[model samples]
Target: MGFKLESREASMNGVALIDDEGRWTLLHTTGERPQASPQIVASNSPSRDGAFVPEVRQPLGAVDMVLRFHVSARGGAASDDPRYVRDVNLAELTRVMRLGRISTMGLVIGGVPCVQRCVVSTSSSGEELSENIVPAAFLVKLLDGFWSAPLGEDRVAGFLRAAEGGSGPVSPVWRIEGPCQGFRAVTVDGVVCEWAGRVDVGQAAIVSGWQSWTVPASLDEWWVHPSAVSTVNVSDSSPVLPDFSGSYAVDVFVDGVKQTLATTKVSAYCGQTFI
Candidate 1:
């Protein structure tokens, strides 16, 4: 697919680069396009009978990119000026490569733009004395296999609990718009359960705009009572009542910033049979 690769430092059309803190940097002028390839990793498990089963783990490796750029004078300068191209532009690009810091990269493939966290694995540069220009290329490895959806206000809303007298798995489905960093914690009746999954939201989920996950009932520590009667007199029996109803709260952070609060209703049944 046709693509444009960009980092905080530069874009294909020669925009100024920004630092991790969103501050402007000295690098400018990027190449026309970038070359990228998809990366997928899987493992095969052998059964006792000799049959193999393939398991795919996430965050899936998404894409590796070869980014190219041209470093030149900040302002308009004559093509023959060696000082502007070599002494200034090349020096800045070299410093950036040597730092080896992880940065957010923008990839626009097939008319869609997505963001990814990546690290520069390799870099090469050569000077063109005739044109007084320095061309540099970098090999970037994507940390997360998914392209982040567009950044904006997005929410996942749905019921997290089953109906009264219902007994089954409760897989809460949420509609997520674009890409997100995922939820931090899901709180049910004041009991909090932290997310134990990949931080990067997958591209397929973003495209579908929906995702579903299950939280084990064992995680409902709040439903347990410290004081409970294991044994009771058969002649005189007392009814036991437990609270199993509350609201569900979910805290989600995008790009490390807290957005609006999203919540849903939840209920748990804790009633004893009457004989």
Candidate 2:
């Protein structure tokens, strides 16, 4: 069996786990014990005296079983405080877990079941190789019935940059302008968002016209016109690729106000790959 490598970038996000039977489960060490369901968790609020209550959690099972997890970096906005482990929708979490691959794993911040110890990140050089791996267990050990969760793990609130889609003979490139319509931002606005992905041009004709794609709460923008190819980066394929060409439109919102942005039509050709 191949050993999984983790990216060691410090992120205030929760880890996602996939079972050996193709089941997707999210592991939240938010409190002193593991939560059986994600719905029962409570949203955070200000403490009466103005102090934040930091919560830690216990592991659900044996750590030595080689628990696998995915880490995320961006959530609401880039936050220095570590209490807001990012939250994600049940469907999205399930989708990633079902794939059962190391790359599908991502950290979630400001997200549900705020994880307190594991931080997933890519190497500074941004190499896709496994040398850039680090698991949360390495940083914090499992305690008798509980793990000594990181104190500041909850203070994580920021953006979630999706990894680039890669595969086959084509290496695609992607750029996020902003949001449009009722959609969310493709890339985090106002803050600098870091993404690990490439724009892919597919061998097949994927887009006949422009299509609107919703930005998961992770990025800073709202919605933008995504050719079918842009959706590939988020697909089951190792690296998602875009396989069409067209003009894109995006809408922007600030202080609840709306705006529209457009991109000149460009060739969405799936280009040649690296050696």
Local distance difference test scores for all models: 0.36, 0.24
Q: Among these predicted structures, which one has the highest TM-score?
A: 1
Candidates in order, TM-scores: namely: 0.39, 0.15
lDDT by residue for model 1 over 1-275, one digit each (tens)? 12132443343222334433222232224433333333343445443444333221112334566665544444435554654545566556555554367767664533445455677777777664234445566777756654443322123332222221222112232222224433332333321222222222232111111222333323333223222222211111111111344222343333344445343112222211110
Could you tell me the lDDT of residue 39 within candidate 2?
18
Scored by Cα lDDT, where does model 2 land? Answer: 0.24
| Tens-place lDDT digits, model 2, residues 134-207 | 12221222212222211110101111111112111121222332221111222111211112232222211122
Q: lDDT winner among the candidates? A: 1
Any runs in candidate 1 off by more than 4 Å, and if so which? 1-57, 73-80, 96-98, 109-113, 127-129, 152-275
lDDT measured at residue 90 in model 1 versus the true structure, 0 to 100: 54
